[model samples]
Target: MDDAVRLESLAKSYGSGDSAVTALRDIQVSLPKGSFTAVMGPSGSGKSTLLQCAAALDRPSSGRVLIDGTDIAGLSETQLTEFRRESTGFVFQAFNLLPSLTAEQNVALPVRLAGRKPDRRTVQQALAQVGLEKKAGSRPSQLSGGQQQRVAIARALVTRPAVLFADEPTGALDLTTGRELLEVLRKLVDSPADDGLTTVVMVTHDPNVASFADRVLFLADGSLVGELISPTSEAVAARMTELAVPTC
Candidate 1:
């Protein structure tokens, strides 16, 4: 499969002197199209930094980030904005929904912001995929946390982005609700409708959350320390224990 994301010697640092802190060091990783990967790390291990850098939400102090073979670092601000709009989707711990907008409107917002007219049918289908078609007209305040999160997922997928970056997507939900959200996300990654063009990368410290990924990348002290394929919560927890890192 083609690479959906490529990071070459990615580095990020804060401050400029003897006290400088490196959040990422010579990081390199890849995510292939239609694959699902999760990143795990301890507090301050650069998990969030890595996700931000990979998604172009933050620039690395050095190195490169490529999406679909196009180097995002080389793009100008306008071009980068376009690139993100056309190629990337993000789901954060917070629902990030507009309280004033209905679920359907929230899902359609991205396409609308891209200066294209919204396709009502496509928007409806996206919501349906998340089992929220019936609630499409409900406002964020009208839905439960899980239902709201599902709307966020729909918003992320509605754009049909090349890659989706989720940061602790289930962090804010109860176990049952989180599992339901994970199921929706897992289905989206494995969906034939993705057409071999979409990939998923999530940043999570929870082994249960990471268990859903096809692969788990472990980071410690700003570097990739290990990787586990076909990961399970048990396996990830064991590895975290071995690494002396606390498991969630």
Candidate 2:
């Protein structure tokens, strides 16, 4: 499919009856293959909800989510688990690395859990993609926060997933380290190699972080309010400022 992810008439809600609260509403968007897109919103804007649904981490209460042109709504929970493991990759604010495992082991954890042999060279290549090839033997305890996050990225991309969804990936790092991480992500999307990682959808509050993406989507109150192409930090920040103001 030309679109890596497509959400059609999507909606999500919690509870039921009059007490129900909707987290996403009539969301429709298509993420083109090999493109980087960022999602931004004020608190309760459902930016995270959109990411989770699009990634198949959570099923929408209504509508359809298509990944690589296949509808996932019909998959059973058991099937969904396997589909996610095989088709998607994720990174988050927390590194979620196993403390006892070395970098290489951590990167290969997903494959190993899937009952497959962990390929040493493939794991190494994942680390090299994140510039952590030399630290493959290091444990999470031995690595800095940035290094740990890099290892997490390696782990996420090890399967060569069609898409990567990151939620505040740089939230825990220092400014310099965060930018370095962003560059790593940027490089992956811009890589010249065919069959390499090229699609990314990140959710973040930092305007600077959002600017690295080819486009930025803005959400407010569970709906997409606007989007910016070729976004700049100044422009993103200003839009965020406007989003923050309460409207009558």
Candidate 3:
């Protein structure tokens, strides 16, 4: 599979000179198309930084962020905005839906924002992909938390973007609901025919959530520290424990 996202010697620092605090340091990694990768780390280890940079939500201080082979480091603000909208999708801990909009309207938002008329059939298909077709008329207030999140996922998927960046997607849901959401995510990546060109990069602290991914990328002290392939919850938890301890 081709690479959907690549970060080359990426570095992000806040402030300047003597007061500078680096949040990401020489990070280099590639996520191939259709892969689901979970990023795990301690509170200050740059997990959020990595996702923000990779997804073009923020620029890096130095190095490159390549999305689908296009280097975004030099893109103008307007160019970056258009590129991001056309090529990438994002989901956050907060559903961030318009409370006034129903599920079908919410799913059609990206298309509408891109200056195209929202297609009712497209909206229905997107909601159906997330198993929410029957709830298409429900407003955010009317849906359960998991149902709301499913709507958010549908919004992300409707764009048919090359990559999906999810930051703590299930953070607000209960365990069972979170697992159900993860299962939905897993099915998306698992089905190459439907989502073969899409890649998923998610920031999650829970080992059980990470286990749903194809691999787990561990970050520490603003660096790419370790990786686990075909991870299970037990293995992911063990790796997290190892990263927490200071080594001599």
Candidate 4:
């Protein structure tokens, strides 16, 4: 499919009956394949809800989510699990690396958990992609915060997933490290070899972080309010300011 992810009439709610609260509303969007897109919104703007539904990490209360052209809403529980494991990659604010495992082991954890012996070459290539090949033998304890996050990114990319979902991936790092990580992500999306096979979708609150993306989707009050193409930090910050102000 031309779109890596498509959401149609998507909505999400928590609780039910009189106390129900909707987190998303009639969301319709498509992420172009092999492109880098960033999602931005204020607190309670449904950014997190959108990511969870799009990644198949959680089900939407209504509507459909298509990943690689397959409707995830209709998949059985077991099938959904398999589809997610096989089609998606995720990175988050927390590194979430196992403390006892070396970098290589951590990167290969997903494959191993899927009941396959970790492929040596695959592990090596993943680590190398994130420039961590030399530290493959080191445990999380031995790495800096940036290194740990790189390992996390490596793990996410190992499976060659159709899309990589990053939520506040640079939230825990220092400015320099965050920039470095963003560059790594940018290169991944811009590289011709990867561009044909993988797409990247990231959610962040930082204007600077969002600037790296080719396009940025802005959400407010559980709905898409605007979008920015070829965004810059200044532009993003200004748009965020505009979003925060209530419309009469």
Best by TM-score: 2
Q: What is the lDDT of residue 207 in candidate 3?
A: 98
lDDT of 1: 0.90
**Candidate 4, residue 239: CA error in Å?**
0.6
Estimated TM-score per prediction?
0.95, 0.98, 0.97, 0.97
Please report how far candidate 1 places residue 182 from its true position, in Å: 0.5
lDDT of 4 by residue, 151-237 (tens): 999899888788899999999999999999998888888773432566889999999999999999999989988899999999999
Clash count in backbone of candidate 1: 0
Q: What ranges in model 3 sit over 4 Å off?
A: 192-196
lDDT by residue for model 3 (1-248), tens: 38999999999999999999999999999999889999999999999999999999999999999999899977999999999988999999999999999999988999999999987877787788778999999999999999999999889888788898999999999999999999988888886335455578999999999999999999999999999999999999999999989999
Q: Please give the TM-score that candidate 3 achieves against the real structure.
A: 0.97
Give lDDT per model, in order: 0.90, 0.93, 0.92, 0.92
lDDT of 1 at 210: 94
Best-fitting candidate, measured by lDDT? 2
After superposing candidate 1 on the true structure, give the runs of residues whose Cα lies further than 4 Å from its correct spot. 194-196, 245-248
Prediction RMSDs, each to the true structure:
2.4, 1.0, 1.2, 1.2
Across 108-175, the per-residue lDDT of candidate 1 in tens digits comes to 99999999999998899889878999998999999999999999988988877888899999999999
